[model samples]
Target: MEFFKGDKIYNFMGKRLPFLGFSTILVVTSIVLLLTKGVNFGIDFAGGTLVQVKYEKAAPIDKIRDILNKTKEYKNSSITKFGSDDEIIIRVTTSTNSVSSDLSDEIRNVLKGTGNFEIRRVDIVGPKVGGELREKGLMAFVLSLIVIMIYVSFRFEWRFALASILALVHDVTIALGAVSLFGIEVNLDILAAVLTLLGYSLNDTIIVFDRIREGVQTSKESDLSKVVNESVSRTLSRTTLTSLTTFFVVATLYFFGGEIINGFAFTLLVGIIVGTYSSIFIAASFLVQLKFSIEDFRTKEVEKIKKQKEKEKMRAMFEQGTV
Candidate 1:
């Protein structure tokens, strides 16, 4: 059950700086790619046609693809088995100018010989809807970041809030860069994965921040860097264990969740690893450069209580004066 023992706890703090520097470089490079090339948005954001067809018997993807490829109408078609092997969802790229009778005729002909399958369903996503979803996704992501910053700032310090946000950005950038470099399609499913990663990465960062805050409260005279190191060490096992469990689940989904969920699972798989790294190396290291001290914690809490008591005393004095 135990992954690591007590002695190894203090070992990582020694080489933390160089590891952090390397992570920073990787994250920065990823950001550059994201800003320029951007993500390959899928049908959910780009708007396309979704068609479902069910066969009398289980059908193979290649066979269905070959039939569709015969017609120039489906040159850009994506063929995959649906929930049941007998069902298939064929996605053909469609535009306002690209819609044609020939494509529909060809699809019907292909399914005629295969089975008693009919057009199970048809949904057309317009450009306007896609554009709106794109805007909404961006807004949701930005708002989540703002909320996280405010919460972290109130709970710990401004420096920690900033560090946590930076780490979230780092995780997102690297995940986006991965999609770009590897040519992964960014669909609605993958967008969900990205949001999930944001939350998961933030959770990891908060765990360390929480530990750092506790250390600051309990050890009044310890060095901030040493306290951060201790905090990181204390939570190392938990982070590793949680990440490993997530990795196993995502890996299973990637291997067995079928083509539809493959991209989503892959995105999550990469995000989990990158998020873990940023939470530890990138986020924790930021504390070293920050002007952090245990006294700040004590002063803020003491000052707030003092101010409250002073306001109460002033109210009492005002009441007596009025009398």
Candidate 2:
């Protein structure tokens, strides 16, 4: 099934400079934001206490805050509405990662005055444990990038592989920048979202690169710009549809999935759009900058591709009754 009919070609590579410039600005801005504002790391990595509670009626957030303020330990804690108004989540930064019965008792007792409520659960993490988790999370992310370099380099030559990786970095940095910009809570789930988008972005890029390779092998065109433009146009319909459909689903999750998954959804939301853009513009532009030509292959493959291009041209000539 062909999404694009006819021989029309779009100048995708021709306008790459603007998109690349825009992407560069966004990436630099995101980095600055991360260095300045930073991300809001959840208790999962910051080392803290989480106290979840449920009330038969809507939770009185203000009244509960006032009541908890009376105590010293939880006075500086944070409270947020959970799934419903009746449920609430309380976070308290702790010096130690250890769970103390006294702390739970204190939190439960302090909120009890707000009205009849049930303590759903309590989670505690100390400073050292939080630091370790934070380190590991960062390590995991970096290691994934390393693996991508290895995997993609194996799939294509170094030039294409490098382009793919740079495009991914662009998507990830901006997504993280958005998180920091919006103060999204960084947690295990959010990290998972970041990693998930890596594969997705790479998949989109590989598709375009694959198309370019086929075009090079068969098209009787020496002009790289035209070949790239044709390849991208052929795949534009699929990329647009896939990204649009996925965006709608993720947008639903961001709007309706509640605060619990908002960060995760937002990461994916930015990822899909940026990923699509980078794959088409950033990745392809980098390939063009690398001076990709028939030289990437050896004598045999180059000669073979030349022969294939000749056959294709002859076939077209025969159809036109010109030879």
Candidate 3:
């Protein structure tokens, strides 16, 4: 349990300011990058054609891509392997602003191979659907933040509420910025992953805050910041171990979760790492800076009971000494 008997490093707390500064700088730089080079939204956001085809045997992905690339009809198309290397999905931009059944027939003709194959699915999403999805995703993210703020404020205090929200926003912005930087396609699944990360990050923060709260109640003689530092130090082992275990699982998904869940797991991996850092350095440190006091911690009824007990102990000691 006592992984770190004393503080791991005597002057470890001083590095917090520099860490905060670097995080702030990175966030600003990411924002600038995003503004200059916006997110490359996938076909799920921008409307396009979708075609899923399965082969009897393992198909040559490069050959399929070459076929799409050489075809005059789908000159500007993005081809990807879904499910497995044998299953191919293609998306082609509309030329005449209309999605015709004839277009699917053309794609089938181009994809017609020597081996046995089956067209599994085909659908065309319009710009209207993309717009609606974008709106809904925005609403979901905004609603999640609002709910988190309300819950943290009601459960803990306003300072903690603000700190947790800031951490969540930081995690989200970084994830989005990373996806944009990598040209990863952001879709409905990715948005769902983002929401899940928000909850996961907040759960880590709440656990650390709860530990700090416990320290404040028990360590009456220690400074509030010291109490917080101790609490975080004590929970560091649990935090690191939990994150590593989760990371291994998510890393597995990232590598082999297929194309569909890969983006989701990638988002999760980044969120969990950053979430752990924020819980320790940002969230707990901000609470200490906010002057979280033991007095502010206890309820009025508890304080009254404590004072009555102290008075009774003092009276008993006085009577025994006089006798």
Candidate 4:
């Protein structure tokens, strides 16, 4: 089913500047926030201990925090309810070089007075390991962009690749900024979500780029901007459907997936919205600004025709000589 009529045309290029300017402002604000406020790194990135416990009965989160607060050592611990009211996860960062076993024992003892609870698991990360993980996570993100740029450049053109990279960066920065601005903890799971968004955003972009490439090859329109605008309009229905369907799925996860997957789902939700916007506005707008001309395609077609004519003339000459 088509959301838009078959012959409908929207002047996306006409409003290119506004779209681009809005994206630019978003990206710049995100960068400024990232530089100044920074992300709230979770236990995985910041050296810490994570303890998951399940109580026999429903436990009030505030009481748990109160129990931990009795001990000065555990006063600053972060407590979050997991899948249910009986389940909770607590994280604490300590400068003390206590072993995981010791830390686990300390945590258990501190909460022993609260209620009968079972320790599901405990994880510990040292400062050295956390620093390594932080570095690698960043490297992974940067490398994904580099790889995407190379692949798009090979599949389409350098201009297309650059534009796509910028869009992907835009999607990621805005997603991360939203996370930070709202004080969502950044962890390995969130990092994975960001990487997934890179691919998701690129897929949408490639679809639009493919249509633009086809339009340039087939359309007789001399105005490259018109060709781009037409190309985006043609794919509007498909882009909207894909984004909406994906958003529904991610929104479900965000609401129902529990605390473990909350960040992941939220990241996907933000990425999908931003990614869809960039494909239509940021990517196509860049093509127009870059002066992507249909002349390049036409010139190549003309050369192919000239070569074919030369071969045909040579064949005729040979046939005449034989005669």
Which candidate would rank higher by TM-score, 1 or 4? 4
- Which is the leading candidate under lDDT? 4
**lDDT measured at residue 83 in model 3 versus the true structure, 0 to 100:** 69
Native RMSD of candidate 4 (Å) = 3.7
Better candidate by lDDT, 3 or 4: 4
The runs of at least 3 residues in candidate 1 whose Cα sits more than 4 Å from the true structure, single-residue gaps closed, are 6-13, 35-37, 52-90, 95-106, 110-123, 305-323
Highest TM-score: which candidate?
A: 4
Clashes of 1: 0
Greater lDDT among 1 and 4 belongs to 4
**Where is the poorest 10-residue window by lDDT in model 4?**
95-104
The per-residue C-alpha lDDT of model 4 at residue 201 equals 94
Clashes of each: 0, 3, 0, 0
Candidate 2 residues 219-306, lDDT tens each? 8788887888999888888888888889999999999998779889999999999998887778888888788774444455768789
- Whole-structure CA lDDT of model 4: 0.87
Checking candidate 1 for backbone clashes, the offending pairs are none
Query: Tens-digit lDDT track for model 4 on 73-147?
Result: 677788987778899988878645543457667767778778899888888787788899999999999889999
* Lowest summed lDDT window (length 10), candidate 3: 3-12
* Regions more than 4 Å wrong, model 4: 56-75, 81-87, 99-105, 301-323
